[model samples]
Structures are given as structure tokens and as C-alpha cells.
Target: MKFAIISVTEQGHKLAKNLLEYLENDPSVIKVDVYHKNVNSTLNKCFEEYDCWVGIMASGIMVRSVCPLIKTKFTDPAVLVIGENGKHVISLLSGHMGGANHFAVKLAGMIGAVPVITTATDLAGKMGLDTLAYQYWLELDHRISIKNINQNIAAGGKVDLYLPTKFDFLKNHPIVNTSYKIDIWNKTFIQASFSGDEIVLTPRRMVAGVGSKKGVTEEQVFFALRSALQHLHLPLSRLDAIATADIKEDEEGIKLAAIKSDLPLMIKSLEEIRNFQHPDCTTSQLVKREFGVGGVSEPAALIEAGDNSRLILKKTAYNGVTVAVAVAI
Candidate 1:
């Protein structure tokens, strides 16, 4: 995710730089662009390019800058305002869907500031499904349903809740008076039915490790990727990210495929991928000769999923492309 850190003074600039250094290495924090002076115009000019905004100035300035750009909480970026002296960080807009509420608490901790949150759901100590969906990287079957749920909760309306399985954390989550019966994880999504403003959240749990020959066509790569996931009883929507060896960074087939589908592509170094081992994954002498690695797909997937990855599917060949699957720990 990207953040636009807007500051007005030298002190604010210092705070912005400090935050950038602190969060620079986090994988989820892709970019933290710092802007000083004329923050309102700059933010007004480039608001869409960022995921969130951190204003290190007066709350009035923040309000004036973001008020004109406000659309809906669902589509707007999460915004937080930190006092110029850095004593308070307030969730200015897009509290839940934009993640400003959660990020406010975190950023406040970094700077010894108090987080000011006015969202009704948060003050009531309830967790809406939309927040969970965003946190888990799950896509809601209907965005409107989640928004409705949050709206009702904010209005002090009582609503019954349901969950398929017990998540230890959700047990104490913001949802009040919810019951559990079945396992949502194992239930077939196609046959499942929910009523009365219930939200359907689809978890993106799969990551595909791909290996392609030089000059592979995007058509062949897409066909092979979809076919592999279908065999595993999962759909393309459930695919989280794409993984491949860094050596294939210039490979247009997978690059274009990821762009076309709008998936996060993780390309690890050849040595990093080769350092890991999969019991069932095959190592080609030919591949080792050209790329200094025995296999690309499986190991790349494993590395992308980190050390605690559980391999679900081994290398499966399709034409000139190979595919693998792993779940992160």
C-alpha cells in the first residue's frame, strides 16, 4: 500500500522522514511519499495515486484539504491528521474501509500521540466484516452488504451475526451476539447461501508459482494458470499473488499476465529460490544450466510464501509454462 505524508513545517517534515525510515522495509508499505508546503494543493492534485494520507499539520488544514476530495468512505483513501507538535493523531476520514482507524493507532504509538477516533462502530467496540475483509485480503461478494452492515452497527441497531468457524480472535471481535455452526472454509462456496444482509467474504489464499520459457506468449501463460487453479477446486478470484524467479523479471509472458489480471507479482532472486527444497518438485538439469537453478516455480512459490509455506500442489507442466501452489504460514 502507498501513503501520502503531507506536512507543512520543518518539524512535520522531520516526523514524515522518521515515519518513512521506520516503515520503509515493511513489505505492505510499498511507498510513503512525503510532501511539504502547499500540502492541500499537492494532495488535491495527486490524491488518487496514494492509498492513505498522513497530515502533519493542523486538523483544520487536513479538513480543508480532504473535504473537497471526499466521495464515499468505501472509495476514498484513509486519512489521518497529526498535530504539528505531534501530540495527537486523529482519524480524519475513511476510518474502517480506508484503514485510517487502524493505522492511526499504529502511527500514534510511533510518535507518542493519542489516537482520536470518532467512528461509532469503533467506539462501540465492534468489528465490522468490511474491516476483516480488508485485513485478511478477502474480497466481499457484495461491497454494498458490508457497507450496510457497518451503517446499521454505527446507528446503534442490533443485528444477529453468524460465522462458519471459530477464529480465536473473532471470538472477541467487535461483532456482538454472533453464533457459529459450520466451517466456512470447507463449505462449498457455490452452494452456500446467506440472508438478511449477511456478507460473503472470499478469502484469497492461493499463490501461484510460475515458470516460463523465454518469449512465452501471454495467452499460453493465462490458460495454464487458470487450468491449474481450476484443478484445485479454486477460481481465479481466489488467487492472491503471482510468484516467479527474479531471473524471469524481464519475461513478458508472466509480466503481462499479472498486469492484465491486476495481481501482485513477487519475483525472488534465483539463489533465494534455489536455496529451498520441495520433496515432489522436479529439478531440470536444463533449467539449472541456463538459470543456475534446478526449478523456478515451486521454490519461487515457497519463497514468496515465506519460510512457513505449505505446498499444496507441486510443479505441473502446461506447454512451456509450469505452475505450483503454496499457502503462506
Candidate 2:
């Protein structure tokens, strides 16, 4: 995770430096930028850029400084406050979704400091719905009443938890089993819509397989992918990965499109795509002649999405690009 450390005082700078030293050696930490001066300007500049912000200052000062920039927890970065003496590390904001509370505890353990977590679920010895969503890489509908559901869980009240069969293992979690009344429903996360005022965590299980002619622009590929998803009435965020045949590994346009979409580019071998038996896979004589495969997009998507997967959208060609979408069973 990327981190930004803001320190207003010399003593706080020292603490920030110490924290940086600890974080730099950790393999999990991707990047860390330290700001020992111009606290206000630095906070404004780095707040949205980094995954988390560590303020080495007083709690009141940190809170007041971030108050103006604070937005919804879904998009905000995790915020933490650590005293100059490094005696305590407090999870100040975005405790659940942004992972401030979990990181605070981990940071405190690293530096031999006390971690102060004030979130209700953590205090009640129960995992919050937001935390579960963050930890398991599940997407929550921001429109839902998450606060009320978490409050219910903390109050020893049971909340309905819906899960696909693939995620049945989560039922074994001690807190989840106790706090939620789970129903195993085998369907897409979006298809299994909420039955009542309960928590619904959508698993990111869709893969978009792409096929494009050489020298095609990233815009063409991206537009094709977006168009295919739009046809299904799904958002771009619902896609988990962009898949293509291994022969097109050097195709910069497809690669750039995947990068621009912020999704992983999964390459499936030609043999895998050819051997796969899917009735919906389009028969392309040109593709068979060029790459020895009947199709690229449909089978590649189905292969990357794994076993028991089904094509949600069949191959749709746009300009020189072809796009298909598949969902894991």
C-alpha cells in the first residue's frame, strides 16, 4: 500500500522518519512519501494520492486538518494519528472500508506501541460489514444502509448475510456465523439482489475477454469492452479482468486497454481456447486460420473465469475489436 506521512514539528518528523524506516523494509508497502513541513499544503496534495495517510501530530490537529477534505468512506484513504512520542497509534477515520483500524493494530505491533481503535464492531468483538467487504475484496452497494447494519451487528442483533456457493467458506468464520443468518444462493452477486434491509457483498467475478486486430488503438478496444458491458446493463467496475489469447501477449493496444481499465490482463493459451467446449463460442474462420483457434474472446473469457463459468454476453464485434463477458459459477 502507498503511504504519506505528514509531520508538522521536528519531533514529529523524527517519529515519521522512524515509521518510514519500518515501512520501507516491509515488502507489502509499495511506496511512502514523507512530508516534514508545509503540513496543510502537503495534506491537501497527498490526501487523495496515497492509500493511507499517517499524521504524526496531535489527534485534534489531525482531525481538524482533515475535516474539510473528508468525503465518503468508500473513496477516502485510511487516516491515522500517531503521537510524537510514538506511544500510541490511533485509527482516526475510515476504520472499516479504508482499513485504518486493521492497519493501526499492525503498525502498533511493528513499533511496540498501543493501537487505539474506536470502531463499534471492533469494540464489540465483531467484524463490521465494511471490514468484511474490504478484507474479502467484496463490493458493497454504497446506496445501502451500511451504518445501520453494522450497528445491528455490534448490538448483538443478527443480520441476513447472502453468499454464493463459492463463498460458503466464509460461513465458517466465527463472527460471521454468529452475527449473520446466511443463505447460500448460487447466482451472480448482482442477480442475488437484496431481499430486505440486509448486507449484500458482491463478489467481483466477471471477466471480459477481448480480441482485436493488430495495430488497433486502445480506445477502440476499451470502447468495445465498455459497449459489451453496457449491453448487459453492467458497470465497468463489475469486470474483474481483461482476458486475451497468449498469441496476443505482445499486442500493445489490448495491453494498454487493460491497463487503462485498471484490470489484470489474463492470457490464455491458444490450445486452451481451442479445446474448450462452449456452445456460445463464435466460430471465426479467420481466427482459426491465423491463430489456430475458432475464437479468442469468448473462450478466453470462459477459461479465465474458471470452471462452471457461463458466457453472459456473446462475442460482440465493434470496428476491429471483439469483446465477450463471462461470469464464474
Candidate 3:
């Protein structure tokens, strides 16, 4: 996360310096840059370059600087305006969905300033859907749905945060008892509803291992992976990465599929694949002859699924492309 500090006056500069000291000490390791806007400097440039903006100038200046650039809740960076004397920390724009409100509260506590969060959900003690999504590292399927939900909640509408799986942390959370209701589906293949401001969040908890013929096309590889995920009732949103054996690391088709999927490709060595244990994996005589292993996909998936990993789906092959899935326990 990057925080850019904008100060116009001498007092604002001093306050920026003081806040910088506290921000630099933050254990979160966020990148922070202070910009004392000069005659040639552009506030518009800061909007695109930084994840959050801290303004010590007037709120009017901050609003005018950010007004034309505001696109959506997901795209805009968090904006905060602190008084020159450090007495007040106000969340200026993109408060809930963009995390400005959370940052405001944190900066307020650190600098002994009162935080002013005008978002209705925050004031009503109802957890914002976007805030919950941010906390869990879940990507928003659509920001408009979140905005609609917040608008309804502001008008005394009740929203439900449904967890398809029974997460222990959520069952005991204090927010469950608040205005937002928590429901655990505890089932696979839970369809998310975009209507009624209902948002769906997936943990992105699975890794897929792939192995393909040397000359296979990237299209074929993608199709095979898509078929395999469908069989498992999983979406690409639940995948963390695509794992492959080291020998296939430089394979063009595999590389292209990983690039197209926008997922990290993790390669495991022969020794690692050999050491992994997956009972239900397919026995490939050709793979055994090449790498002296029963299978590549299952073992690689097991290794990349991380510690205490277990295979959730055995190898499935189609059109010379093979895929297996594993889940972190």
C-alpha cells in the first residue's frame, strides 16, 4: 500500500512531517510518499500513482483535486484529510469500499486525533460489505452491487453476509450480531446472488496442477483446466495458482495458459513431486518413464497447496492436457 501526503501550507508541512514519522513506524510496511505541492506539481498525478492520499490542506482542496478523478469505489484510492493542528482526521472520499475510513481511524489513533467517518454503516455500527470483503482479501465481483447494498443499508435495509463455508473466525465475530446478518451455507457450489445487494466472496483457496504434451496449444490447456474446475464445482476465482513440474516450466503452452489466466505458475522439482503422496492420482506409464514418477499433476498440486495440503481432486485428462486440484487444510 502506498500513502501520499499532500501539504500546502507551512503548518500543514509540519503536520505532514509529524504524521510521516508515525506512518514510517507502521509495521504494515506500507510505502508512503509526502508531496508538498509546488507550482508545477500535479495532484491528478498523485491519484493514479498512490493507493491512498493524505491531505493536510483544506477539505475543499482535497475534494476539488479528487472530484474529476473519482471513478468507482474499487478504482479510487483512499483519501484522508487531517487538520493542520492534527486535531481531526476526516475520511474524505472512497471511505468504506476504498478503505479510507479504516485508514482514518488508524491514523487518528496514532496521532491522537478524533476520526470523522461520515459513512452511514460506520456510524450505525453495521459492517460495510466492502470493508468485510477487504478484511478477508476477497475481490469484489462488482462494486456497484456493494454501493447499492450500502445505500439500502443506509435506508434501514438489512443485508446478509453469507459464508458458504463455516469459517470459525466469522462464527465468533461480534459483527454477526450487528445489523448485518451472517449465514453459513457449509456446502460446495454455492451460487452468489448479485441482486438484493447480496455479495459473494470466495477464499481463493485452491491450487491447480497442470501437465500437457510438449506441443499442446494454450487454448487446449485452458479448456482442459476449465473442464476440470467445472467438474469440481469450482471457479477460477477460487484458484490461487497453477502448478507444474519443473521440466514443463519453459513450455510455451503452459506459460501462455498461466499468463492468460493471470495466475502465478509454480514449478516443483522432480524430487519434490516424488516425495509428495497422493493416493487417488492417475498412474501414467509415459510420465513414469520420463520423470520416474507415477504422475506430475497431482504431486505438483499437492506440493504447491502448501503445508498440510491435501488433494481434493485426482488427475483428469482431456486432449493431452492433465489437471489436478489440491486444497490447503
Taken over the whole model, the C-alpha lDDT of each candidate is 0.73, 0.80, 0.74
Query: Could you give candidate 3's per-residue lDDT for residues 211-251 as a string of tens digits?
Result: 88888889998898888877544456457789999988988
TM-score computed on alpha carbons, candidate 1: 0.59
Candidate 1 Cα misplacement greater than 4 A, ranges: 145-148, 151-185, 188-195, 205-329
Looking at candidate 2, what is the lDDT of residue 63?
Answer: 87
TM-score of each: 0.59, 0.62, 0.59
Q: What is the lDDT of residue 244 in candidate 2?
A: 94
What is the lDDT for 173 in model 3? 65
Q: Please count the clashing residue pairs in each candidate, in the order shown.
A: 3, 0, 0
Query: Which of the predicted structures, 2 or 3, would earn the higher lDDT when compared with the native?
Result: 2
lDDT of 2 by residue, 149-263 (tens): 7788898887777676656766777877776777778675622223365445677578988888888988998888888876554557568899999888888989999898889
Badly placed stretches (over 4 Å) of model 3 are: 155-157, 187-198, 204-329
Cα lDDT tens digits, model 1, 200-282, are 65554568899988889888888888887765545554566899987888989999988876788898887776677755456
